[model samples]
Target: MISVVIPTLGTREKELIRLFQSLSSQTLQDFEAIVVSQDNHDKVKELLAPYSFPIQHIKLDQKGLSLSRNVGIKYIKGNIVTFSDDDCWYKSDAFEKVQSYFDQHSTGIACFQIYDPEKAVYYKEYLKDPREKVGFLELFRKSSIEIFINLSVVDKEKVTFDEDFGLGAKYPSGEENIFLYTMHQEGYKASYVPEVVVYHAKPSLDTRLNNKAFASKGPMFKRIFNTPIGIALLTLLFLKKLNHLEKPIPFYLNSLGEMFRYKKSRKR
Candidate 1:
């Protein structure tokens, strides 16, 4: 059996409907849908009441995406786990392909490709071959919003989405990357299957830029395996931005000094 987990914030009703509609058309039927909402459960209930699947709703008072995901995972009972976003819709064979891959390979994780439906026609031209397996780092390099993970065979004891990273938290990214990197470090194999596709809604340019800038800083100070090259890159990036700031030298110096302090603390 497969458990499809979706973590949402009680908004995006249109997107949610699209997601559920896609699920209803899935080629695979031996799966359960678990929706984790960070708001009133009644809203989700009313939205999904018409659906004819074994759908379960989990309400979380906490506002963090990671917290919502953890709550969803707790309610999942399938041998294979799949995650999707409320704003994304999957292909009919998405779960079928995922389950097929798991059946063929005794591995820890598996993932698929995500494209913006509005830009699907250009996906072939614009999409770069993700040379590496689908994991947290690779996902970070490509996007911040969409992540697909197969957590069934993975060591559940070691798998968790970092609450400190992702949306509604201090840093606006890196939770998925951190989780995948940690899983790899713990000796889990990850596979990427291209046939399992999902269409994610694109955010506005400003939102994308803000998230990119915010996400770039996360690896510098928050990551566990911070390297010298990573630190140097972050320093150079920060210094370049600092040079552009319309502020007094004292202000820039204070900020730089604080960054150095943070680096030192993280090293310890």
Candidate 2:
């Protein structure tokens, strides 16, 4: 059986409803869902109450995505454990494709492509490829599949999301990257199935900008490169060049705004 783990926070309830609905309609029905909501258990329960799946909603008082995921994994009892973000909706046959790929391959990690719902034109221009196998490092960069593992394989290999990096924490990203990196280091194989796709609604421009700015200088970058100052400088220079390429004035203005916000946050 497959156990789908979702680590969520204050997500859009409507989007989550759609996600659960999509999962319920999956071609493969031998799966359970485990939702770890950080201090939002009541809301998650209220929203998922209508669903007929074996969903176990766990509450985590802390506000870290990594911690929430750890909590969710503790209760998982499936041979294949799948992960999905609350805001992401899987296609009808996504899990089926994943199961098929896993059955054929002896890999520890499997990933899939992600489509942006708002970018219809871009989606048409790109992302029209079938599923294929890929290396772990390539999966680390482009694959959107959250880590799905076989519980039996856990003892043989060690992998966990790094709490220092992820959303709503000091690091704005790189949790998945670090997890996959660790898995690869432990000699675990990974595959990329393009057909097992999920759709993620992009955040607003403002939220994207904020996340980007924070991610550029976040701890994840520092850990990966060991050059925080260099990364910060490069990000600043890139923002300057990007501004010149499109909207120079607004880009610099936003950069300055982000810098000020960063400084103010640091002072606190």
Candidate 3:
């Protein structure tokens, strides 16, 4: 069975309804959804009541996306696990495709394409040659919503989302990257299926430009790998933003400084 775990702040009732509605329309119906919310359960309870499939609405006072996902992971009862956000929903054949891929590659993590209604293309490079089976590095080109993990592999590896990263945490992103990287490091195979399984509504440009989102990368790299990786990442980030920002150099410097600070805190 495939288990869809969603970590939500319970604020997007309209989006949640749309997500559930999409799930209800999936061609494959052998999945369960675990919705982890930080807000009162009553609000979501009413919204979820209309679904035909099984859904477990879990509420917690804690507010980190990773924390909520970790909590949902503890209660997962399916052999395969996939994550979704409140604003995203699956294609009708998505769960079906996921099951098909996993059936063929029982030991591999399956990744598919995500369509953004607002954007002409999302992750264009990664989207190309969807039939290609990629390694740890290639998986970085995708997001958590685009992947379906084999729960047996994860359980054996004893891996969970890092509480320090992701939405609602100090670091607003990179949890998915770190998670897939860890999986690859552990010798798990990652398969890229040339299929669009999900769709994400575009986030605002302000959210994308939020310094907190990029700031976490420095510390995350330092803590997970080393200072060299952190430095390299910061440098690469600078080059990536070289043409777009007015003061990319200062931003990179500040990121490196934050990395050093985080590294120091780790030693203490």
Candidate 4:
């Protein structure tokens, strides 16, 4: 069976309705939805009851998206698991395609594309060709919503999302980057399928080199690489994306400053 763990603040009643409604239409019925609500348990409970699939409403007092996902992992009874955002929904055939791909492929983790149905475009530009396997550079571009995992291949290790790197955390991003990198280091195989399996709204920002983006990315890149190398890469990235900045030097310096705020994770 497939398990979908969605982390939410329980405020998206309207969007939840739309998400569950799409789940109800899914051609594959062998999946469970685990909604980890960080607030308004009663409201979320009320909202999810009308859905056709079995729903596990997990309440969490904590606020971090990564923390909620780590908690959600413990409650999963399905062999195949996927992380989901409360506002995103799957296509009717999405689960069936994923199950088929997994049944045929030996990949431990798989990443797919997200489409913005209303906008008539992909959630972000995707690689045109599917990759049989991918690594760190590929993971950096992926959002949490596009990932699905085969639990059996990875259950032996103590793998969980880093709470210090996601929404409600110090850096506000790169949780997936760190998690996927760890999985790769653990010797698990990952694949990139060039198909759109889920639908989400267009992001308000897409890697624009703004002050907040610069600040968040500093620690993210630092955690992903050696300090000196990370600093070099960060500087290179700043200069590379300089066309997006009005004051390139100050924004570049902000990122340089924040990189020091995070000491790189010790080797496993």
Question: What tens-digit string does per-residue lDDT give for candidate 2 at 1-268?
Answer: 7888888884678888889999889999988999888866788889888989888888888997776776787787788886677788887887787778678877666666666766642121233453444564364354224446755555422545667666666555667766676666676666555453677765544554453443433344444444555357546655645533345445445444443343212211
Off by over 4 Å in 1: 121-152, 204-206, 211-216, 219-221, 227-230, 233-268
Number of clashing residue pairs, candidate 3: 0
C-alpha lDDT (0 to 100) for residue 84 of candidate 1: 70
lDDT of each: 0.64, 0.64, 0.79, 0.83
Candidate 1, residues 1-268, lDDT tens digits: the string is 7788888886888888999998899899888999998876677888898889888888778887766776677888787776677887888887787778777777666655666768544222233443245544453343322334455567555656777666776555556766666677877766555552677755643454343433435353436555555556455645655544444344334434433443322211
lDDT of 4 by residue, 1-268 (tens): 8999989998988898888998899899999988999999999999987776888889998898888988898888888898888889899999999999899988889999999989898987788988888856777788888988987787634568878777787767778888888888888888999988999988654354567667777787777777788888888887787777767888778878888876654422
Q: Candidate 1: deviation at residue 133, Å?
A: 5.5
Candidates in order, TM-scores: namely 0.78, 0.75, 0.91, 0.92
Give lDDT for model 4.
Answer: 0.83
Which residue pairs overlap in candidate 2's backbone? 131-194, 243-248
- Winner on TM-score between 1 and 2 is 1
**How does residue 12 of candidate 4 score in lDDT?**
89
Best by TM-score, which number?
4
- Report RMSD (Å) for each prediction in the order shown: 4.9, 5.4, 2.6, 2.2
What's the true lDDT of residue 75 in model 4? 86
Q: Over the full model, what C-alpha lDDT does candidate 3 score relative to the true structure?
A: 0.79
